[model samples]
Target: MKAKTQRLYLVLGALVALGGAGALAFSTLGDKATYFYAPSDLAGKAAPVEAIRLGGMVEKGSLVKTGETVRFVVTDNVETRQVTYTGILPDLFREGQGVIAEGHIDPASGVFTAETVLAKHDEKYMPPEVAGAMRKVEGKVS
Candidate 1:
């Protein structure tokens, strides 16, 4: 075979391999991806069937505990969404604190059933997405 023909075949094989790898990576990552949203973003929207990450401040006076389960309301001031979570919560979890909950919203009841609840890591640290959302809400209010 000609040297140029050999080189072309090699390049074609490499491109096919790269394409397959890219497709595999995307498919794997897609399954694990969880979209982030603030309370305001959920208002008047159809509840997502897949798991998602909801972030906002825990509304004061909205925490309710029942056995191993806890229910609370998260708010961005513009809107509020009720969240229910079972199992132990993070030690830092508290009312009036920024939180991100991962789970799916019940289309029938509009309640978020969280599989995992994450609290702010420190007193001054807030998730960047949550911070940006709060700022956007504040900007609208002002």
Candidate 2:
């Protein structure tokens, strides 16, 4: 085979391999990707089937606890989502504080059944995403 023809084949083979690798990476990442959203982002939209990370303030006076299970409302001031979790909550978890819950919404009950819940660490700290969302909501309200 000519040198030029051999080089062309090699380049084509590399491109094909790279494309396959890219496709595989994207497919794997898509399966595990968790989208973040504020409660208002979900308002009026069909609930997503895949797991998601919901971030917002724990609405004041909206927490309820039972044996090994807790339920609360997470809100961005424009909308709220009911979240239920059956596990120990973070020590910082409380109403009127920023929180992030990872889970899927139940199709039948329209509730966010959380697998993990995270709370802000301190009074002066909030997740950047949640804080930005809250600022957006405040701007809209003003």
Candidate 3:
């Protein structure tokens, strides 16, 4: 083949390889992506079947524990949702504290079944999503 023909084939091959790599990257990342939502966001909306991160403050007087299982209500003041977790909770986890629960919501009951519960590491620390929601609430209140 001529040099020009050979160069054209090489360019086409590189483009095809790059496109294939891009497609593969997107396909793998799609499954790993998790969405974050607040309690109010779920209201009047169909519960998502896939795993998601729920961020809000743990409602006061809503925590209940039975053996290894624990249930609590998360709220953004405007809305609330129940969450059930069956594992050792973080030492910082407490009622009236900001938290992010990672798990799937049960569509039938509208209850979040969290596989992992994340709480603030310190008094001043809050998850970004939780903080943003709180700011939005404060903005409306004032």
Candidate 4:
């Protein structure tokens, strides 16, 4: 091969190698990706074993306390979703506020077993999870 052709082959080979490495990394981390969704999305489109983020307003008068476990409903304009969490809730977490949850969906019962919950901090500042929750609460896009 000519000198330039050899260099081009080397660069192409390097690019291919890098592309393969990126694909592997993405595949490994894909399941780890957490997506935030509205109550409607949870109730409607999510499939089993699919990791997602559930966000919405914590339903007022729906927060139930049982020892360390807390149960509440998240609502979107289109639907409402029930969640049972066995852990301490955030101080910012309250009825009628935005909240987002990360976990996989259980198609059988149609409930999400959240590994972590995201609660909003303020009117302007919102963490990823918190943002999802806010959108969930907002429901309709405006």
Error of 2 at 55 (Å): 1.0
State TM-scores per candidate: 0.92, 0.84, 0.87, 0.75
Cα deviation of 54, candidate 3, in Å: 0.8
With a 3 Å backbone cut-off (N, CA, C), the pairs that clash in candidate 2 are: none
lDDT of 2 by residue, 40-98 (tens): 88888899999999999999998999998999999998889999999999999999999
Cα lDDT for residue 64, candidate 3: 100
Q: Which of 2 and 4 is the better model by lDDT?
A: 2
Q: Which clashing pairs does model 3 show? A: none
Name the candidate, 1 or 3, with the larger lDDT value.
1
Off by over 4 Å in 2: 2-5
Q: Each prediction's Cα lDDT score?
A: 0.95, 0.93, 0.94, 0.75
Model 1 weakest 10-residue run by lDDT:
41-50
Candidate 2 lDDT score relative to the true structure? 0.93
lDDT tens digits, residues 60-132, model 3? 9999999999999999888899999999999999999999999999988889999999999999999999999
lDDT of 2 at 67: 95
lDDT of 1 by residue, 5-52 (tens): 999999999999999999999999999999999998899999987899
lDDT score, candidate 3: 0.94
Q: What's the CA RMSD of model 1 in angstroms?
A: 1.4
Show where candidate 4 strays beyond 4 Å: 1-5, 44-47, 125-142
Each candidate: how many clashes? 0, 0, 0, 4
